[model samples]
Target: MIEAAFRVLKVLEESDTPISGEEISKQLDISRSAVWKHVQELRSYGYEIASSRAEGYDLIASPDRLLPYEIEKHLKTWHIGRYFDYHDSVPSTIGVAKELCRNKNPSELHGMVVIAEEQSGGVGRLGRAWYSPRGGIWTTIILRPAIPVDHVFMVTMAASIAVARTIRKFCGAGALIKWPNDIYIGNEKIAGVLQEISAEAETVNYCLLSIGIDANISEEQLPSGVKTPITTLFRACGAPVDRARFLAQLLREFETRYREIESGEYHTIAREWKSLSLTLDKRVKITTPRKSFEGEAIDIDEYGALIVRKDNGKVERVFSGDCTPA
Candidate 1:
C-alpha cells in the first residue's frame, strides 16, 4: 500500500541515521523483503532512497508530486475526502465525479473527492468554461445530501466559504467571495465554484460541487485571454503553499459548514458568507438571456438568490446570471 510505503519513508526520515531493513520489518511487523519492496515502491514514486547493507535505507528526498498518501496523511475529516482519486490531467474532475456517483448509491458518495493536477475542459456555471492549468487545485466533491433541490446551492456557498477560510489561514490572503460563486483577492479573481445538479423538481439525486483555484500556478500559466485579472497563492505569498495541506484544510472546513447546512443553519452560513462577500452593497450588472440591468447587491435570500436593488428603484431577485461588478 502507498500509505505503508509512506510510513516506511516517515521512519527513514525521522531516523537520524539509516535504519536497517530488519529494524523496519520489525517495526512494521513484516518480512525484511517486504520492507525492501516498500522501499522500492517509495523509490518508484520519486523518492531517493539510499540503500546499503552496512547503513540500511536513508531518505534523500521526495518529489513534489500530489500523492494520495501525502494528501491523506494530513486529511482530518469524517467523510469529506476520505476517498480521493488523483490524476495528472483530465478533461474535468466534475465529469469524473459525476460518472463515479452515477454507478453508486447515495451513501457511497457522501464525500468522495476527484482531484486533478490539470483540467483541459473544466466547466463552470451557465455553460461557461473554466481555465484550469497545472499547479492549481482542480477538484470536485460528490455529495448526495438529503436536502431539497432549492437548498442545493448552499453546497457551492459552503465550498466557497471553505476555500476562502483556507486561503486566509494557509495562504494568508484576504480572500473575499464574489456573489453567487467566485473568490477574489482585492480586485483579482483567485477561485471559482461550479455546482452541477441532477435533480427533478424539488427532489435531488446528486451534486458535483466543483472548485478551481490558482494555488501555485504563476500568472504566466493562466489563460492569456482571461476576461478578469487573476492571481495565485504563489504570487500572493511569494512561495508555493502546500497544495496537499490546503486541500485537507479545505475539506475539514467544508465538512463543518456542510453539517451546518444539514442541520438547517442557512442563515448562519449566509451571514458568514456576507462577511467575506465582495458583492454586497457594490454596484453590479446582471445579464440574463432576455435583458440586463444594473443594481446594488442587497443580499442573498434563503434560496441563494441574489436580491438586487436596481437603479430604477425596483428590486430583482436574480436566480442565475452573469454577475459583473460595475
Candidate 2:
C-alpha cells in the first residue's frame, strides 16, 4: 500500500502543475479519499506534499529511503524483482525469505525478493556473521528453479557474474570473481554471494540467492570485528553510485543468466564465470576442513570445483574451501 502511495507521489512529482484529487484517483484507479490517505501516508514518511482545494497535491521534497517505488521505477526485468519486499531493518533477508516460503506456496513465490536496508544478524558463507549496516545493498532473492541439486552451484556462479557485471557497468569498478563466491577489487572485498537451498533426493525444492554489496557504505558505518579490509563502490569511485538503478541492472543480468541455467546452458555460464575469475592462473592456497594445500588454480571443473595443481604434480578438485593468494 505504501508503494502505491509512492506511485501517487511520483505522479505528482513528475507534474509541473498541481494535480486534482479526482485526477489522481482516476489515474491510480482509487477513490479520492484513498488519494488523500496516501498523501497523508507520504507525509508520514518525510515527504513534503502541498495540497489545495482547487489544485491537488504537489510533491515538495522526497526522502532518501530505498522505497519500493524507487526500485520499481528502474526495474525492467520480467520476473526477478517483480514481487519485492522492502524493510528498514531485519535479522536477515534470508530468514525473512525462508519464512515467507514456508508460509506460502513455492510455485507462486518464484522470483520474489526480500531486501533490507540494514541487517542486524546477517550471515555469510561458512557461518560467518556479515557486517551489514545502513548504506549497503543487502538482498535475498527467492527462486523455485527446477534445476537439480548437483547444478545448484551454478546459481551462485550466475549471481557472481551479476555482481561483477553490475559493479563494472554502474561504478566502473574492476571487480573480479574470487573463487567460490566473493567479489574483489584489487584484493579488497567489495561484495559476496550466499546460496541456501532446500533439497530432497538430490533435487532442489527452492533456492535462496542472497547478495551483499558495499555500494555506498563508509568505513565508520561498518561494524567492528571485520576480519579483512573492505571497500565500497563509493570509495572505489570517489563518489556514491545510485543503488536503486544498479540493483535493477543486476537483476536484469541475473534473470538473463538464470534463464540460461534453466535451459541447460551450463557451459555458457561457466565460460562467462571463468572470464570474470580472479583465482584462475594464480598461485593460491585452499583450506578445507581436513587439510590445507597450496597450488596454482588451473581451472574450474564442470561441477564448479576449483581445480588446483599442487607443486608435487597432484591435481585436486575442491568442492568447498577457503581460497587466498599463496
The prediction achieving the highest lDDT against the true structure is 2
The Cα error of candidate 1 at residue 269, in Å, is 0.6
Model 2 C-alpha lDDT per residue in residues 1-326, reported as the tens digit of each score: 78688778878987898899999888889999999999999988778889889787878887655666777788989999889888989999999999999999877889998989899999999999998988899999999998877888999999999999999997677899998999999978999999999989987788999999988888787656666678898998888877888888899999999999998998999999999999999999999999999999999865788999999999999999899889
Candidate 2: residue 114 lDDT (0-100): 90
**lDDT agreement with native, every candidate:** 0.87, 0.89
Candidate 1, residue 292: CA error in Å?
A: 1.1
lDDT of 2 at 197: 94
Q: For model 2, what is the error of residue 33's alpha carbon versus the real structure, in angstroms, after optimal superposition?
A: 4.4
TM-score of 2: 0.93
Backbone-clash count (model 2): 0
TM-score of each: 0.93, 0.93
What are the runs in model 1 whose C-alpha is more than 4 Å off? 1-4, 29-33
